[model samples]
Every structure is written in structure tokens, then in C-alpha cells.
Target chain A: MIKYRQELSFKEALTVILYTLLFNTVIAIVLTYFLKPFWENFVFSQCIGILICLCMLMIFRFITTENPLLWLLTILSGLLVGSAGGFILGAFLTEKNPLVYIRQYHEFIRIMSLGLIFGTIITYFFLSRVRISQAEDRIQEEKIKRLTSEKKTVESHLKFLQAQIEPHFLFNTLSNILGLLDTDLTKAKLMLTDFTHYLRLSLAKTRESTTTLSQEIDMIKAYIEIFKARMGERLKYKFEIQDHIGELPFPPMIIQPLVENAIKHGIEPKVEGGEIIISAKKDQDFLRICITDTGLGFIEQNNNGIGLTNIRERLNSLYDDKANFEVMENVPCGTTVKIEVPIVTD
Target chain B: MSQIKAIIADDEKELRTYLKAQLADVWNDLIICGEAKNGPEALNLVDTYQPDIAFLDIRMPGFSGMEVAEKVADRCRIVFVTAHDQYAIKAFENEAVDYILKPVTRDRLKITVTRLKEQIEVSSVPPSDLPAIIERLMAELKANQKTDYLQWIRVSSRDGIRLIPTDEISYFKASDKYTLVVTGDGESLIKKPIKELYRELNPDVFWQIHRGTLVNVNFIDKVSRSLSGRLVLKLKSPPETLTVSRTYKHLFKQM
Candidate 1:
């Protein structure tokens, strides 16, 4: 029906008008047959011709998008063919009076033209509308498709980030373990053991679009071990969260850069690695995350570190402005960065 | 038992270096043969190192992980490192092998290495499936790998039948007996059915909306209803509209 609406033709429209006209003409004759013979005069015959003309006019509205050349041919054909039909029909009905046959013959020709001209004009009007409607539909469809594709890309990009970040994170941690390999083999071996478990959990969750907060935090804790191994006695960090938000859904790799930020801006800058606090709290309608670091704050000159910017963009894109991120000087001297976003609910 | 030699192939410089660095820590039994930046580099590394295992990245320049693995088909086992998609992952899984998703984890690497060791220990996975897996992976690359042009198309004008590149097409519409292939500059009258075109053209590029028409999926905007349950596509640029068929209702799901 949509295709038909978009591509209706004049030939098809004319054919429908012609058919309707003939159909109405025949029905008028049948009614004339049933009417009282005393009242049936030349006026009644003219009335039948007008009835056929009206039917053709109405049909023109239905098929407005017909081909001009094809429609012209169809309308001309309808006129010639219909006139002949009326002449034949007239010959049988008005055989006794030549005058009656001639008069009715002229009347039938006029009725056919009425059906043709009006049908063509009205059909062309409706057809232009069809074309307009189809164009509008196409525009709307393109917008939706673009949005969907963007969503997929955002989703895929999120996955890719996780994919890119996870191994990179793991490998870095492994390198930290490697640093301890010669110095402390037993501790390095234990790090490897815990790291492997963390990786299994991470890889297991890779296919999913979202995971629970508890699951994400556990993965984070596993990751922090490698950092702990790297920082040794210098680093300090803690995990804080409310119990109810454990099942809230967040995208994979939500905590990825925050931890890195804690390490980069918070722990790494200090001679004795400063304490890094990673907390996830539940707001009335959102999950509040604070990756506060007790070290040098973000270098104002170096505003676009890949980790902080990437996290901010992903959060903005995912949660729009619903996400809250704050980077401010800590109570004493270090930087405290806070991030809050809507928790995904089960 | 002779030690199993291994090499890491990845596009990321940091990843390959980091993997190589991390591999040094554990797996004392395995030899750290070499590393390559891209697929071709890795393929060359394979010739030089001839390692027992190749860790390949599915997406890479010159050759994919799957392609380089083909060169070392019989000699070594493959552990694909992919971002994770059903079309690509199936190739490795079907062959009873494994893939490590990026960012590589120490634990996952251990698991994969453990799987690799087991495969070598038993000689369980068939070497013959390598060719088939390679072919399947290549086909997947063809499927998921998007193109700007149509695959097999034939266009007609006063000159004769010329195959118009899919990208050159602006739009297509079914006229009485023929389908008109409209372009930015002109149109082509071709005697081709939309169904045949749908099968031959890349579905990733071209989409079927109406019985009479197959539109470039990229050209479509959104599928919306006019009156009742009718559906149509809002296109980009020259900005035309198209209608969808009842038969293909499930296609525009989000719309």
C-alpha cells in the first residue's frame, strides 16, 4: 500500500475512473428501468450521464500521482472508447428516433470528457501529494537510521574501549608483576594468580553490554592489586559503596580510567604514592562515584589526558548531562575527582 | 618435549610491547620468539621465528590475524585476539581453538596458554580445519567489513550495459517493467529484479524496504508510519522518502 501510494500512475488512475464511470452508467440505466415510465423522459437520460461524470471526478482524487503521458493516452482512450460504447448503447435504446439518438450521442461524449478531464486533473493533484509524502517518510527514516547507527557505534566504541583498556590494563599490571618477578617471585606469583582470576571475570563480562556494580568493583579490586604491587608501600586506596546499588547496571569499563586517574594524578605524582580513594555511592536516582586522589591535581596546562577526557566523553554521551564530574583541590593539597551517573537498575 | 615457540601479532605498539614484556614474567617453559606490529610484519616474523603459536589481531593492516595464520596453517596453532563479534568469533570457536579479547588480561592469557598447551599435548584439533576456518574468517571479513559500493550491479544507457558502482547510485525506483537506477548526474534503466539485486548487493549497504525497491541502507534515515501501520524511510541529502513492506517488518526494529 505504501509503494502503491508513492508510485500511483495516471494510466492506472484513468483506468479506475473509466471503469467507475461505466459501472455508474450501467447502474443508472438499471434504476431507470425500475422507475415509473411516465416520469422517465429525456431529463432522466441526461441525469444518468451526469451521474457517470460525478463518479469519474471522485475517482480522480484517489490516484493523483499518475504519469502525465500515460494518463493523457488513457484519458483519450477512455473518451474514444466510452463514446463508442455510448453510441452502441444509444443505437439499441433510441433506435426509433434518430433525433433522440443524435442528442443522446452528443450528451454521452460530453459526460466521457467530464470524467476524463476532471479525473486527470484531480489525480495529478493527489499524486503530487504522494510524492511529497514519500519524500517526508524517507527523510524521517534516514534520521532514525543515523541515530540507531550512532547508538551502535557508541555501544561498539564502549566495547572497544573495554577491549582496548582491559588488556592494556592487564598487561600493565603484568608488567608491574614482572618488575617484582626478579625482586619478589612469590609476591609476583600471587599477583599473577589474582590477576588471572580478575581477567577471567573481566573477559567473561566482555560480551555483555552492562554488568552489576559489585561485579565491576570486584574487577577493580583485582586491578588495584597490580597497582598495589607497583606502588608497593607508597600507595593507599579504599573502596566505599552502598549495599543497595550493587545490582545497578553500568557499562563495561566505567571504572577503567578513574583508577588510572587515581594512579596517574593521585598516586604517581607523589614521592611517597599518595592515598587514592575509589568510592561508589547511591544517590536518590543515581550512582555517585568519587575517585579522589591525595596527590597533584590535574595539571591545568595538560587538560586533555586521554583517560580523563575519554571517561568524561563516554559518560556525557552515555548519560547525556545526567553524569556529574568534579575535579577540585583536595582538603590539604591533592586533587579529588568526583563522578556520578544514573545506576542501571535490575 | 621440545619447547613451544610463540609470537605476538598486534596493531597497537603498546599492546605488543606490553604483551612481550609480560610474557617474559611467566611461561618460563615457552620461548618468547618475536613480535610483529601488523599482520604482514607478523607473517614475516613467522617466517623468521617459525613459532609454534601465533597470537593474531583480527583487525590489522595488510593482513588480518586470520590471514597470517593461514601462511603458518599447519605449523602453528592460532589464538585470535578480537574485539568480539559473533561473525568473527565463530571462526575460532568452531575450530575448537580460542581467542583473547583485547585488553589482554594476565589471567585470560594464562587460560588461553593453558588451552594452547593442552591442544599441543594431545594433538586434538585437526590441522585440516585451518583452511576452512581461514575461509570462514575471510567470508566474515567480507560480511562485517562494510563497503561504499555495490557488489554485482549492471547499469544500462544508450551506450549499453555498464555495471555501475554501488556508491555512484543515488536512488532506485521500479517503473512499469524496468528499475531505474538514479545517480547524482543521471539515471540508468536496468532490467533487474529488486529481489535479485538484494541477494547480490551487500545487505550491509543496500536495504530492502518495499517490494518494488531496494535502498542503500546508508541512504535511509528512519522508518515511520503515515496513517495506521504503514512504514517509510526518510533519506539523506537529496532527501527522498521510501516505503517498507509488510514482509520485512522485523528489519526496522528500532524505527
Candidate 2:
């Protein structure tokens, strides 16, 4: 019996079942005759044969059909054809006791009634199994939908976090340019062009998700340049990315926030300037990005704002907590933002 | 030729004062026709003063120095003044009449006035001719600059040219005859002639800081001027001090 929709075969399954039943019936009759040569000459034999064939056909139809009305019609046809064949065969094959073979009419009628009842019950079982299978499919679909939605939300946040960086940088650079006008025009003019170049870059990358890590690092470098241009020599940054991890895929704008956090809270707040260190490497099958600043170490009060919260939420949404992102002190110096995720590939 | 009387156009009151003082200090003969705090004021000043020289700031709250320059057209020869040196440098590179960097360095402004004197002395050309000259200068600079502020170079080894954005490059090294572009993680060796690249690069960004070498100024970690007056540039990648060749040594002091 085909329980699930996937197992459902229309006309083809029906023909295979009927052929198997017909072969089985022929074998039964041949064995009965060869063993007792009586069924070939018997008047009741034809009636018995017709009854057996009808029962098998109804069961086959019931197992295959899902439509309840079609099942009932098929089962009823089985009974009618079985009885009509029995009566007609009895009349043609009987010699002396034709009425006697036909008189076993009650047995033939009983077979038809039983066939209808058994066929309906069998079909009911298959339908229930079919329903169970469908429920399982629905559950699997929901799981997939949930996972996809989670990925989308996380990605959107990652992109948001990344996008947030450029604007903040733009505004800050603009402020620097503005500040320069009152004191130093030449430097401001240079920074303005640098800032413009940075902005044009951010605009160009509006479509992609995972830019090459090298490209991203360059952008960060550009951003740092703007600060350097403004601060003169007040800020310094270093890259310690492992050589092997250079070609790895990473979320866009992933490292930018940590850099900004270092700048906004770490370096900018202090006098005499500070240094920012960025490093990336593969540790235990994961790509780990670490951003450390010489600014004052992590203070709970300053970082509780929506930025970290948003980053955390985005991380959760993307990797389902598979990625590890944390903010901790770099011991004697300052804050370090470490982001660890599976090494993704393009 | 008539005297090139000029108005000082700046949004900041102090810079305006500085321009007036500096202009007067440098060229004692330059007539200070007037000064305006905004573009409209500058325009009105240009109209009333009919000054031959107008010192304008590139960025004003409402209108830019260029916009004001367009308006003054033939009335006065204009010089843009802004604190940002690169833009001003680019303007001059573009063949702009002249521009002064902000803080209005006394010596630079003095040079500006001398240029103004020449423009005023030779100022018989029509204003219609001025815009065209400016446009031609801009085109010439654009075509002449080899690096169009390239963010990436998409060059292909397989296809003969792969375009890699300038921003994608982490650092560049001069490899004998060709420049080796250490791209993010995936590096590529580009066949750029070092000397030609130096001539074509934006000095403020891609500096041909070293002989046979060009470095993205964005990637420079520390730059120091040596005792011999050569500039040494340190980058994050090479972890070494790259000395600015004597030929290109003059550039480091500007930043």
C-alpha cells in the first residue's frame, strides 16, 4: 500500500497490482486442477474463481486510490462484476447442476460485501499515513524557513553595522574638514579629498556582502588615513593578519565596528593619542578577527549602547550563536573586540 | 590694465581678517576693496568693489567657492582659499587661477597676490575666456593624472587585465621592473612601470615616496624626515622604513 504522496503512482501501480493478482489466481487454479483435476470439470469452480479475482482487484484499487468516492465506486464495481461473472460463468459451464453452482449465490454475495468493507478500511489506513507524512514535510519546511529568516536578519544586521561605519566616518571626516577651515586650510583640503574618496568607495560597495578581506582591510586603512590626516600623528594602527587567512571570506563591515569602538571610546577620548592593533588568523577551523586599541580599557558604562547590542543581535541572527564575538580587556593596555566565525568561502 | 582690487570671501570671520591682513602684508599695493562673510556677501562685494581679485573658500555653508567663482565670472580674478591643502593642490593642478590653503600662510598668500598682479596686469582677456581656460585646465589635469584616484586595479593574469579596486590593495611593493600589488590576502604582480606610476599617482594618496616605488599614502604607518631631508615611510605590511627618494623628497614636508 502506498501511504505517502510521494509513493502515489496513478495508472501504472494499478496495472502492476492487477497483473500480480491475475498471475496468483492462475497459479492457484492450476495447482488446484493438477492436484485434483476436479476444478476444471466442477460447476462451482468458475464461481469460486470469479469471486477470488474480484476480491483481489478491489483490494488493489483500494490500496492505490486516495479519493474516497473513487474508492467506493471501484469497490462496488468489483462486487457487481464478480457476482455477474459468477452467475454468467455458472450458466455457461454447468452441465447437470448449473443451478446448484449458481445456487452458491449466497457465498458469492458474501464475498462482494466483504470486499467492499475491507477495501474501504485499507484505503482509510493509507490516507492517515499520507496525512502523517504531510505533517512531517510541513515541519521540515518550517525549520528551513526559520533558518533562512534567521540568516537574513543576521546578514541585514551585519550589513547595517558595516553601513553604519561609513556614515559615522563620513560625518567625522566632515567635522575634521570643518575644524581645519578655522586653523589649517591646506591639510583640510587634502583630508576632504581623502574623505571624498572614502565616501565614493562606500557607495560603490552597497551591493556586495562579503568583500575580499584585503579590500575591507584597505578600507579600514583608508578610514585610518582620514584620522591620521586630521590628527597629524596622534593615532597609529597596525595589521597583524596571518598570511594564510588573507584569502578567507568574512562578513562585510565585520571588523569595522570594533575599529570604530576602539577609535570612539579608546583613542579619541584620551590625550596624547593612541594606537589600534588589528589581527586576523585561523584558530581551530575558525577565522578570528581581533581589534585592540591603546585607548582606555573596556568600561561597562561606555559600551552598553545600541552598537554592541545590535552587533550581538546580528551575530546571533546570522550564525545562530555559532560565531563568537566578545569585548574584553587587552590586559595592561585597552579594549579588544574579537570576532570568531566559521571560515566562510565565496 | 586696471588695479586688481579684490574682496576676501570666507565664512569664518578670523580667516577673513587673516586674508585681509595677509594680502595687505604681502602686497602692500593690493587694494582691499571689501570683505564678505558669505557667498552672497562676497558676490555683492565683488559687484560693488569690482575687485580684480577675490579670495574665496571652497566650502561655505550655502554656496561653494567654485559657485561664487562662476558668478563673479569676469568681474574679478578669483582665488579659492580653504584649509584643505589637497583640494587646493588639486585645483592648482587642474590649472585653476590660484588657491590659498587655510590658516592663510603669509608667504603662500603673498605668492597668490603676485600671481594676482600678473593676472590683473594681463587681465584684458574677457570673462567668457576665463571659464573655458579653467575647463581646459581641469581636463588636462584629469587626463594627465595617471592614477585616477584608483581604488582598485582589476587586472587579469588569465585574461590579460583584471580590474582590482584600489581599495582592495593592502600595500604595493616595487618588484624590479613591475610593481607587486599585495592585495588583501590574494596578492598580484602588476606590470606597472614604477617611474611612470610615480608620475601618474596622486601625490597625497599614492605617493611615489621612494625611488622605483609607489605606496598608497593611506597605508603609511609612520613617516619621518631624515637628517638628509629625505622622508622615510613605514608601512604595516613590509614592517620596514621605506625612504622617500631624494627626487621625491620634497613631497613629505607638505603633509
Candidate 3:
């Protein structure tokens, strides 16, 4: 069974009727002057032709679904049926037997041939017009889809750039190093060493698709050390990881941004800075990494921050449904973010 | 001439010490009277030492540097110290206000000191229009910050989390380590500190009546004075009376 491309509406049917009437009136005027038949008889015959053709088209539409073959059959049958009905009805209205035109074979053939030619031209015009519109609609839909996908790519790229280097963190750490140089020489050396390690790891890892879990944890340790010096005595941290889990391959920069969020939104804002705990362990077929902070409890402002959203997008693209991210309020105070991804051993 | 006294206020101890060392190298006669690690300490240092100059970092705990400046603009000549704040730097430049960038070098400190000394010598009489300029800068900064005050506060109840709209809250009272969010329904405890909540709340709607209490102005029913002439507030909901501290009693002067 063939399917119909589109259903006809009442407005389209009305437009077709109006066009047919206009075309018939033009043909009737020319025929009246050339054939020398009465103008009234010509108009009367054309009206009968229009009525018969509309009735036949309506019956065909009700019985069969619309398709190219159906349309062709309707148009060809309408031409033959309408011309025969018009000739018989016109002869009977002029007080003659309806069979008089059928008896003149030459006149009957000429009138039927004219009807076929005119019907084919009109049908081709309407069909081509509908096809062009359908093609334009398809193109428009494809354009919108392409634009939306392009926009998504650009937005994610911009987010990646923002996640790479935070200007405030860079400048503040530099200022801390500058200050430490004059007061504590050995401490300054330690900070410089850790800062170098952090910059090298972050810059290098961002270029690669994945890294061992140990490397990401090393970068987080370096980050916490820099903050430890800057926030001296106020900031504390602990890392707990199961043995043999550090060597597993994981997506790079996933856990680091969450740590940054905890510091930026939770710890740094509080009067008494708090501790951050990073723990990783394997559970069944997945690796669970949790970062917990003891600072101000979860606030709505953190929800809109780019850090959390960026991490969510990265996880979705990399692991799809195999990864899970969750945020929960700690029991006493602060927030804990958990990430669980499938552990692939290869 | 008497020795010029100065105070340095920054959250980081290293920045404070570094700035002090740079000042000592440039201006020998200047005395470093005090150092503050946060905003409240900075204000306290200014009040006690009566410093001639104050170097206030823009971002600090308890209150921001701009907030501290708003309180002590008249007590000392203000020189803002910041790491990198684009909007604030632009505002400072436009107003011709004195400011210094962090990781202080000797050259920048020398310039700031020279400028401050001349200003102090020229205006030893009274406070100038610096306060007005500071106010404008603060307003601009707040506008740029797009500070949308807390509309809904999430609190834990007996069963689960409860989100209460700010309009429904009557007041917030500080307890031991948590704050009590009192409403018409009852009170729920939150882990957020009163001081931090004060900074997040809209100042016009929630007035800090005491160090430990913040009363929503819309919920205030009556204002009366005690026998000792201390101000007291009567709230409509929960129908409780709150005492106003000496520092914040001026907020109810009109009533």
C-alpha cells in the first residue's frame, strides 16, 4: 500500500475551484467568438462541464487515498466524463436529442481531445507547485537542525576554555608566591615547586583525552598545597584512596573542577576556612570518587556556577549513562559531590 | 612632623607583611601600627590605632573591603589593595581614588605613599568628599555584581528539606553553631552563620537589629524603648520581642 504525502485542506480545495472557473471562463469567451455558438449556450455547457468534473473528483477523493497514480487517474477520467456530460446536457437544453452530438463522430473526437490537453496542463501546474513547497519545508527543517548542533558545539568549546585557566586563581597564586619570597625563603621554594607541578599537569592533561587516576589526584594534591600555604593553618585536607585503584585509566580534569568548586563556593567564602577530603574507591563494577568539604552548606548560588555545569557536560559526552554525578548536603555542614563511572579494566 | 601611622588589612598574612616591608623600604618615618586579616579586624584596627592611612583588600571574610571602607571612610585616608578587579579598577581610575594592585613592588608603593602624603598634608582640616566618591563606587560595584539576594532559603525539617520563601520568614536568631529561621509556622535550624546570612540577605528588607539577630523589616509590628532607653522590636509573627544592640539602635530612630 502506498502512503499519501499530505492531506488536502478546505482552503486548498477552494483555491483549485476558483482557478478552474477562471480558466473555463477564458476558454468559453474565445470559443464563443470563433465557433459562433450563442454565448449563453457556451457558458451553460462549460458550467455543466465544471459541475460534472467536481462531482467525479470528489467521488475519487472519498474512495481512494492521494498518490501520483491516483491523481493521474482522476484527472484523465475527469476529462472524458466531464466533456461527455457537457455535450449531452447542452444538446438537451437546446431542445434537441442528447444523442445528436454522439452521432457526429468528428465533433465528438475534437471536443474530447481539447479537454484532455487542457486538463493535463492544469494538473501539471498544481502538482509541480505542491512539490516545490514540500521540498522547501524539508530544507528549512534541516537548516534548523544544523544550526542547533553547531550552537551546541560552540557553547561546549567556550565552556572548555573557561575551565582551563581561571584568571583569579592564577593571579592570586602568583601574588602569594611574590609575597612569600621576601618573608619565608624555604616556604617560598616549596610553593614554587608545587605551583610548577600544578601548572604543568593541568596544561598537559587538558590536551589528552584520559589519564591514570593517580595523575589527577597528584594535581589535586598540588592544588591543595598551594591553597594550604595561602590560607595557612585555616585550610586542611586529606586524601583516601583504595590500593590498586590509582592506576586505572579515567577521564582527565573531571574531579579537579569539583574540588575547585568546593573551595571557591564552600570554603573560601566562610570566615573559618574548612577541610576538603578526596576519596576514591572501587565498588563492584564502578569507581566511586567523592570530594567532601566542611564549609558553608550547599547554597543555590553554587547551582548556577559554570564549574558544576562544565563537569556535568564532560561526563555526559564521555560516559553517557555509564556515569553518575550526585550532590548532597553533608550531615553537619558543607557539601559532598560524588562521581561514579564504570571501571573498565583493559 | 609627627610620624605617619598606617594599617594594612588583607586576608592573606603574606600580602600584609609584604606590603609592610615595601612601605618600610620606601617611607622610613612611616609607622606600621597594625595588621588585619579580615574586614572586621580591619575596622577594629582603624578605630583603635586611628591610623593615618589604611590599605584595605577588596575581598575579605566577615565583610568586604568596600564595606569596611564605607564605615571608616572618615577615620583614615583609604587606599584600596586588590589582586585584580576590573570593574573596581575602572571605577577607581574614573574617580581619581587611590588604589594599589597586589604583589606590591617597591615602585608602586612609593607612588601610592607619595600621593597619600600630599593628600594628608593638603587636607588636615576635615573629611573631604571621599566618602561620597566611595559610596558611588560601591553602588556601581554592587550594580555590576548583580547581587540577587536570597529569595528562598533551604532548611532541613524533621522529614526532609524544606524551602521557605524569604517573605514568609519573620526573623533569624543566632544559636550556638547554627541559626534559627523563625516564621509563622515555627522555627527551623540552618547551618549557615548569622553573619554570612546577613551579607546574603537584602539589607533593606532584613535589618540587623543586633549582632546575633536579623529582623525582617516587613514583619516589624511596633518599636518601643526599654526602661534603660534600649530599643526594642515587636514582631508580628511568632509574636516575639527583640532587643536592639547599641550599634544598631540607630536603625529605629525614626520609629
Candidate 4:
């Protein structure tokens, strides 16, 4: 019943039948040389053979079988019916008994059997190939659908992480300016201008995902400059950078968060205040950066913050498994935070 | 004009000093009775000094600004100092609960100061509305503060398990099955894979400049483009320059 349904349209089927007729006609002409008696009637006998084959093909449309035994049975039955039709048609055209005509043209019968066997096997091979390809297409579509949904989930999670960063630094600077507004308006104005420049740089940095090392250092300097104006004698920082490392690309906000952490945990707790030393160096294949502070050493109780986790997650996403971050105690009494990223030249 | 005693409560020392200065400028007769760096300290100062006005930062270390406001509701007129934008502030404006944004602009502070003067001169704060206003602001503040991110990394060392801060890492290199955790003091080997560590590290600090290397971009000092169109990166680290391959060269073109 399945095979009875039209797989090809009327036009397509016609074209296939025409090509089959042409192919058989050429095969019939080539066989005439081997059979001397049928040479004069070769075209006529070949037409009869082709006509019988077409009839057998039409009958195949009514049957469908996946089992190999049933497929073999179908092929045998088609060959029997086609050869028998050829014998009867040949006898009528030659005006002789069907048995005599078959005996006289027995070689032609052999050629018809060979053609039927090859045609049946070739059709089955093509049909199975189509079925396999169709199944593969379904699987591919399902995989794409799953991947699209997964991508959406990851995108939303990323957006949530991005939304958490508030402008707390801006407000803090503003509060500092307010204090200076009464005691010294001139210093307050200067602080305000510095704050504005910092704000502009921070905003611009946020717009991009990556920035050059020099730009980040400048941003850090601007940040430290604001802190100096506010803290005055309380904060001291030193930057020891090796030659020609600024042009390398880096992510923004990394240095600022570390600096803030050092100030908040490492230095602020000590009444006497402390200094921060930031340095960078190259060690074989890595670019090493460290932030050292002269304040209270590592505290077990206050060990975590958002900035550190964010750095970890970002490194994982950007570098896969190539970056490292570490924190340790500085000599004597302070905290030192170090980071090592692969030396990427671009 | 009668002097009005006030207390400024904020976690940041700089902020406390700044707010006091701003208050003096806006209301010359206002006298700063005390200052507290945390919410609990603010409450204790209020109890001890019994100031007429309290400027409470919405967020603080001990009992948050809202909790302190609730406790001191009966004794003083409250002015909330907040850093959040929009929704909560709309409620403050609607209910006539005086609030000021950070960096207290002169113009905005002037308005709040004038309103407070009129309210104190007219009568004490109506006790009935104080609790409801504090409750609404408290809920909003709680909602706003829920956003958080990770901040620490636990690294194993010969000195036992050390909780290393993420920012302390200089660079990470491949070491067989593990990654080398290079710090200022020394290096430790962590079992975490390079790709996995990269995902966890902050992208801003660590950059993968090569297939096997992650350079701390903070230490990068210069980039040199040779005549043959190849790029090399120099870092603040000891005399070393990294070769930038064709794939990563785009990072320096924009600079």
C-alpha cells in the first residue's frame, strides 16, 4: 500500500520511464550481434521486452516489502511474468508457437533475465539510501533546537551578572567632595573635576569588554588619584612596572577592584594606615602582576567578596582554562594578591 | 536661630566627614553632636546623645540604616542617605519622607534642608506614618541588595589549604595535569585545569595572549609591531617580551 502512493509526480515518472526505454533500446541493439536469426527482428523483439519490463514495474507499485526473503520472491515473480510476456509477444510477432519461438531465441531470454536482476537490485539500493538520509535530517534538526535553548539560558545568566555592578564608587567620590565643599571649596572643585574624568573613563571602559594594558593602568591611576585626594596622608601607593608592557590588552575594572580590596581589608583596619605596592613582571611564558599592602595580613573570617568570584568566572569564560589568580600573606604584616595570565602579545 | 543637634551615621569614615561638612554648609545653625561608622554604633550614639536629627545611610554594617531608623523613630527626625536609584526614592518623595542621593548635590541638599527646617519648626514628626515609611524603604533596600557575585579562591599549598584572593595571581601556566599558581611570594600548583581556571579568573586581569600562556594584562608595558607585521608584547615583569600571533594581533590594532 505504501509503494502504491506516488513518490514521484506524473512528469517526473514520465521522464524516468523515457530514460529507461532509451537505455533498454541501446542494450537490445548490442545483443542482436550474438543472435543471427533475430537480427532482422531485433528492434521489434526489443520493444516487446521493454514493454513487458514496464508492466512488471507497474505491478511493483502495489507491493512493498522490507524483508529480504519477500524482496527476493518479488524479484523472481517479476522476472517470470516479464519473460513469459516476452515469449508470447515474440511468438505473435514471428507467427510461430510460443515454445518454438522461445527455443529459437533462447539467448535473447538470457539477456532479458540479466537486465531484470540488475534493475531490481539498483532500485532497492537507491530507495534505502533515501530512507537513511531522511532519518539523519530529523536527528540534526533536534540537535539544533536543543543547542538554541541552551544558548538562551547562558545568555540570561550573563545578563544577570552584568546587572549587579552599581555606581557605588561614583557616589563615594561625591560624598568625599561634599566634605571638602565647606573646608576648602578650591580642593573640592579639583576633586570634582578628577571625579568627572574618572567617571568618563569608567563609563567608556564599560562600553567595551577588553582594553589595552596602558588604558587600564591609566584608569587605575585615575582611581588612585581620587583616593589620594580623599584620604590625603592615609594612603600611599607605588607602581613598579617593567618597560613596554602597557600596550598589551587587558580587561578593565580588574586593578580597581583589587586596589579597593586592599584598601578596605588590608589597610583600613590598621589605625596607622599602610602602603600599597603594585608591580608587574615577565616570568618565562607568563606576565605576572601583584598588589601588595602593608596592613593586616589575611583574615580567615573575612575571606570572600564579589570581585574575586567575578574575576574567576570571567577568566573561565574568556581563557577557558589558561588563567590563574592567587592571594597570599606579604612578608611581616600585610596581604599580597597576585595574578598570572599567559603572555598574549596581541 | 536655635541650634539643632544632629548625628551622621555611615560606614565610610570619609562619607561621615563629607556628610557633616555638607550639612554645615546647607544649615549653618545645625551642630554635629556625634558621628557613627556603623548602624549599631549609630543607634548607641542616638541613645546616648539624643540628637534632634539623624542622617542614616540606608546600608551599614551592624543593624542596617532601616533598623536604626525604626529604633530611633520617636526621638529624632530622619533623613535617609541612599545610593539606590528610582523605585524606593519615588516612595520617599511620595510620602514626604526626606531622602538624599549620594554626592548630595547642593541644589538637592538645599531643598531637603528647607523642608526639614519647616517640619521641625511646625511640630514633631507624626508618629503614625514613621513605621510604614520605614517598612516600605526597608523592603526596597532588601530587594536592591540581593545582587551578589563570587569573591574568593581556595588554593592548596605546602602551608596547608590557603584561601588566595583571585586578584593576587600574576599568571597561570600549564604544568602537566595542573596549572601553576604564580603569586608575588612564590608559585603553587593547583589541580584545576587551565581552561577551567580561565573561566573562573576575572577576564579583566588575566588575558590569554598565547595558546599556552595567560599574561596579566595589568603588567603589560608596551606592544611593538615589527617591520614584518609581527607583534611582540613587553611586560613590567623581568626582561621578557611575548610574541603576539596572528590570531591575537587585533587586540593591539585599536590601541
CA lDDT of each prediction against the hidden true structure: 0.63, 0.61, 0.77, 0.68
Off by over 4 Å in 2: A1-169, A178-186, A316-321, B1-255
Ranking by TM-score: 3, 4, 1, 2
Could you tell me which 10 consecutive residues in candidate 3 chain A have the lowest summed lDDT? A1-10
lDDT ranking of the models: 3, 4, 1, 2
Ten-residue stretch with the least lDDT total in model 4 chain B:
B145-154
* lDDT digits (tens) for residues A1-346 of candidate 1: 3433232244544554565555545544654565444223233333333343433343343445546665556445544444445434444554544356467776555545544454455445545666687889789877886696587646656665465355545555655565556566797798888788777777777668678888888888887776676556667878888777777888777675567666754555454457878788887887888777777544421323445445555666678657865555555656566778876544
The digit string of per-residue lDDT tens for model 4 on A26-101 reads 5556666665554434544454446555654564445556666776676667655665666567556767666664
Q: Model 1: runs farther than 4 Å from truth?
A: A1-92, A99-346, B1-4, B118-255
Residues B1-255 of candidate 2 have per-residue lDDT tens digits of 445576877654545665676666788877788877666777888777677677787655345566677776666576777665354466576564677666556777667767666655654543557766655544554465443443334344542333344543455677876777764335677777766555654556676655666777766766765434556676655455677777877776677
Q: Estimate each model's TM-score.
A: 0.42, 0.34, 0.62, 0.50
Query: Tens digit of lDDT per residue, candidate 4, span B1-255?
Result: 467888998766667777776777888888899998777789889999888889998766556677899888877889989766566677677777888988777788899899888887887554566777777777766676532222345576654446665555566778798787665446778787778767766676777876666767876766766434567676654435667778777767787
- DockQ of each model against the real complex? 0.03, 0.01, 0.13, 0.16
- Of 1 and 3, the candidate ranking higher by TM-score: 3
- Predicted chain B of candidate 3, TM-score versus the true chain B: 0.61
Error of 2 at B20 (Å): 15
